[model samples]
Target: MTGRFITLEGGDGAGKTTQAALLTDWLEASGRTVVRTREPGGTDLGQRIREMVLHERGHVAPRAEALLYAADRAHHVETVVRPALERGEVVLQDRYIDSSVAYQGVARGLGADRIRSVSEWAADGLAPDLTVLLDLDVTVGRARVAAARGDTFDRLESEAAAFHETVRGAFLDAAAAEPARFLVVDASAPAEDVQRAVRTAVGALVGIPAPDPSAS
Candidate 1:
């Protein structure tokens, strides 16, 4: 069986981790082997890169940050993602190129096209078969992050409200541009609702039946 690549994209506190776990559970129950991973930490090198890019206290130049992400992507795709997919497993990723394009490209004023090009090159033109974009209000996302993390925030999460709004808009624009590859869902809804929407989209793509809504 050929493998499938599916990615979850959204702002922080958008319940991506939660949804990923739920999706993994559903896929496993259906007798599919799944490889659950996330960008910038999917591999050993990626873990170090994740720390430097996300948790570093000092400032990192815009271009430098983008390159760092690309480097991580290159290594991650070459190592973790590709190998899992080759084994005919579902590679359910938490975030991918869209996160870079949204955060470093538009929000950082580095130009979306350039960032995307760099990312494409880094990942060797690998794109997810389905990218589930969990759309949420920026303000609400920030509030959720605050409640979860308290006063501590990562470099990206520490960004201003306006930055996050720009990121959200960029994600929407990208989804609009590639409607077929994206399944946009309202993430402000309950977690179960979002999971159901995700499962429906993913099931259709993978030729599996989505759980009956009435069952939940």
Candidate 2:
């Protein structure tokens, strides 16, 4: 049986990492083999590319940035994601094509369709079975990131508030366009509340019975 693919997407500090870890832990507790990974760093080559795109102190052209992301996604999906899924393990990824579509396409003015085409071709059309989108106000998200990382910002994180707002809008647009594949959750809630919502959403996908609050 082919395993399910789940991707977590959101702006910086929207709690994607926390949610991914929580989901992975819950899924493992349920006896499912889970392959947790992230794009732009999922593979050896991708790690270098991730550094270039995210932390390198230089101006990379918008198109070049898009292509670098596509390259990483291509290698990551081919080597890491596909093989794990083929082995019947759930592949939980931190980011996927939607990140590129929003970050490069809308925020960087690279055109969403163009970036999507490049990313689709690179990943060989491997779309996630489910995408959990953590929606939060850009200002709130930025504040969270700032509070967590004192005076440190990656390339994408350092962008102006307007840039992040565009990225947030793009994510919501994508979710709205594909309601079946996306579960949009308000991320401003407390971490415990977000985790509960995540568990409930993912429980349906893996056929896990909902938690019995009274039993616990």
Candidate 3:
């Protein structure tokens, strides 16, 4: 009995990390084994690759950046995500192929299909059973990120507002294209409200009841 795969995605400051933590705790309290991890840093190799892609001293070409991400995805899936799922543990991932498609493909003008193909090949066609998309205005998302990490802009975070706007559109388009696999939530809401929505959506996948406020 293989376990389910759940992914959380959104632009920066969409509260994915917070929601992921909450969801993991809920699943664990429900007696399900959960493996919570994130992309570009899930493994030792991935951590090195992450630094190169997001914090290297010099510029990396758009295609090079995409391939680097693909490399990390390949290793991460084989080493961390797949083994956990094969052991029948729920795999809760933060960011995945969707991030590459939006950031590299649509935002960088590198072609979404092309980026998708590379990522699919890297992960050997693995995909999440459900992707929770936290949607919010680009400006609000950026402001949240800035406040959280003052004077520290990552490679992707430092991009112009217009670039993030394009990335946000790409995320919405992806969600629209695959309604069955995606649960889009308005991230402008308060954190607790957003976590409630996330719990409701993920509970269905794991055959658990809706979150109990008292338990939380």
Candidate 4:
């Protein structure tokens, strides 16, 4: 069997990057071939798309932005993600279709069905066997991101509070829709606590023993 694909989704500063790295380290130590990557990045084309989507000061129409993301996703899946999974490696990603479903579809008011259809086409039938959602309050999450960035902001950082709330709500709704496929962790918890919860959840879902705590 191919190794499992696990994608982590969350709002800004919800610790998706930190947690994904932690999990990757633990999984590797436990003897799994892990292919770690992030969407809107990973591949060169994807990185370019990422820059346009996040760093560009120029406003893009919501539908156009959605298409850019879908295009980037298509290239990423075909060139990097698929091959890794086929080689029996567990592919861990920081973001995936869920981001689009929330950002462009819900928060940007682009229509969920249309976004889903485009993303489904881009994904080419690949879906995460399991998804880990790091749920943090919008206010707290924004603060964390702001703190890390030394008071600087990206294009997304300039978005209104209402937009962030919509994104968070969309993610929670997506989690609710796929209860069996998701594990939602309270991201406001301490890092060690977050690691513990993730370790427990992953072990349970994959039928694998938890990594040695000390190693983790």
TM-score on alpha carbons, each prediction: 0.98, 0.96, 0.97, 0.95
Candidate 2 residues 1-216, lDDT tens each?
388899999999999998888878889999999999998899899999999999998899999999999999999998999898899899999999999999999899999999999999999999999999999998888889889998799999999999999999999999999999999999999877787877777888878887554321
Give the poorly placed runs of model 3, Cα more than 4 Å off: 212-216
In model 1, the runs with Cα more than 4 Å from the true position are none
Q: lDDT by residue for model 4 over 72-100, one digit each (tens)?
A: 99999999999998898888999899989
Candidate 3 TM-score, C-alpha based: 0.97
lDDT of 3 by residue, 24-112 (tens): 88899899999999998999999999999989768999999999999999999999999998999999999999999999999999999
Error of 4 at 56 (Å): 1.5
Q: After superposition, how far is residue 56 of candidate 3 from its true place, in Å?
A: 1.7
Task: Look at candidate 3 and tell me the lDDT of residue 161.
Answer: 94
lDDT of 3 at 113: 99
Task: Tell me how far candidate 2 lies from the true structure as C-alpha RMSD in angstroms.
Answer: 1.4
lDDT, candidates in the order shown: 0.92, 0.91, 0.93, 0.88
Worst 10-residue stretch by lDDT in candidate 1? 207-216
RMSD of model 3, in Å? 1.3
- State how far residue 170 of model 2 sits from its true place (Å): 0.3
Task: Give the candidate order by descending TM-score.
Answer: 1, 3, 2, 4
lDDT of 4: 0.88
Candidate 2 — which residues are off by over 4 angstroms? 213-216
lDDT for 49 in candidate 2 is: 97
